[model samples]
Target: MPHDENSTAGRVATQERIETLEADTEIPAPDLDTRPPSSGATRQANDDLRSLEAGLDRLQTDPEHAPRAWQRFTTSVLPPILFVLALIAAWQLYVVIAQPRPDIVPGPLDVLAAMSQAWESGRLQTAVLTSLERGVVGFLIAVVVGTPLGLLLAEVKPLRRAVGPIISGLQVLPSVAWVPAAILWFGLTDATVYFVVLMGATPSIVNGLIAGVEQVPPQLRRVGTVLGAGRTRLATLVVLPAALPGYVAGLKQGWAFSWRSLMAAEIIAVGGTIGFGLGSMLQQSRELADIGGVLAAVLVILFIGILIELVFFAPLERRMLRRRGLLGGTR
Candidate 1:
């Protein structure tokens, strides 16, 4: 009986000791309703995030912060106008100071007079219109041909490997270098001009599209595949849209090349039924020793290039950037 009682007492003592140890070592359950106090760094980070969100929201909603149409127009136009005027003034000053022969370095007024004469003779309009028509036609053909060529090159590795260096080499080759071959092939016709233009423009466009395709993230392709898109659908719908910026850059460069090639062809491929272009006018003036006429023709070419950029490419680029939210603030 005494032994049983001693054993029970020992068991009770052991139980009490376990309970005390557990009470000493146990951690309190975390409060579900109460959060820990934030540190200074955490509070500062939260404040910065909120500020950024508010700024973005204001940018989206506020019209007053955006530039007005007239403001934008003035900002774009005024600087160029001022620069032109300054250039004209400098040219006039140089003519007055140097007293160079009119045949060698004509004054701005002399060039203007030459321009007036050309205008009165209707040659200026004819030259501009002819060149513009050829340029537009050639550029359209290039776009049609190049877009597909570029896509194929970008998608097909073996083809790209075979032709990629050739394309790049062609781009580097002067468009003027092709004129002799083109003339020999097409025999001093509009076909020659178009051929040179195509040679000049197509490579740039193909390379551009290839570059754009390379820049497309792999994740985008995987996502399209997962979403049940075929190769064509993935390329057309996803890749093309993402590659637009590079493609547009290529297009702009292609047009420049086309214009330059056309000029070279017109200058060299003379004495046929081909219509007189700006280059033809310039060459004629040079042959006639008419410095004023040459300058006038050159100015007309410059003006046409500026006009096309302002009217078409600039607005197109701006719209694309704005739509993609890549353009921020008042453009």
Candidate 2:
């Protein structure tokens, strides 16, 4: 009977310990495991990438594909204006810091006033027009003469072998160096200026066209040959079109040479119907020690250079590059 009572006591103790443990700790509820994002979410991401690629392709291929209207305000108009304002601010700061004598280096305001005076008097317009006309005429002459010469060289192996190096060599020789010979040959007339411009520009244009022709793909030549094109027709229609970029680049450089050559001739060959160009005007300002006038003339020269490059050549270059898909469209 005592053994039975001891066993009952042990059983009661075990039961009490089990109840205490169960009350102290809680059991966790069964739950499902986390799964990844759905297939619809993945499909949405793929569609977005495809849309982006399509937009980029359109930008490359479509000329009329305009950027959003807001981009015009943000990119086309505001940035250049802001940059010009910044440039002016920097000029003002420089003037404040340097404090040079007016005759030595006139401030921006002085140059502006001098330009205003010339503009009001109409001398600036006449002088600028004179320079522009000469430069444009000279450049056109170079293009007319140089393009044919370049093509001849490109088409004829024997002639190119004989004269190609000579043509390139002339490019290194300064146009000013030719001015002395030109004056001796033609005297100080307009002929001398035109001669200098031609000498300066022709070699550059020739070399540029030659380079473009050289870069024309052999595949393109083969294609033209397969189409039963003769040498002249192939070059004119196929190879020349392919070489437009290098040729255009050459034209740009040739124009630079023409402008510089014209300026140099104007400055050095002064008097006797040489005409009053900005270069001559600058020289006169220097002679009189009128720093503002000198600076104003320089500003006008810079403006014209920038204007032509921006308005004419830059657009042409961009259009060519865009058509080739070598450059993306404007943002």
Highest TM-score scorer: 1
Report lDDT per candidate.
0.88, 0.86
lDDT tens readout by residue for model 2, 205-276:
999999999999999999999999997899889999998998999999999999988888888888877877
Give the least accurate 10-residue stretch of model 1, judged by summed lDDT: 16-25
Which prediction has the highest lDDT against the true structure? 1
Candidate 1 residue-wise lDDT at 200: 88
Candidate 2 accuracy as TM-score: 0.77
Worst 10 contiguous positions by lDDT, candidate 2: 19-28
Q: What are the TM-scores, per candidate, against the unseen true structure?
A: 0.80, 0.77
List, residue by residue over 89-178, the lDDT tens digit for candidate 1.
Answer: 999999999999989999999999999999999999999999999988998899999999999999999999999999999999999998
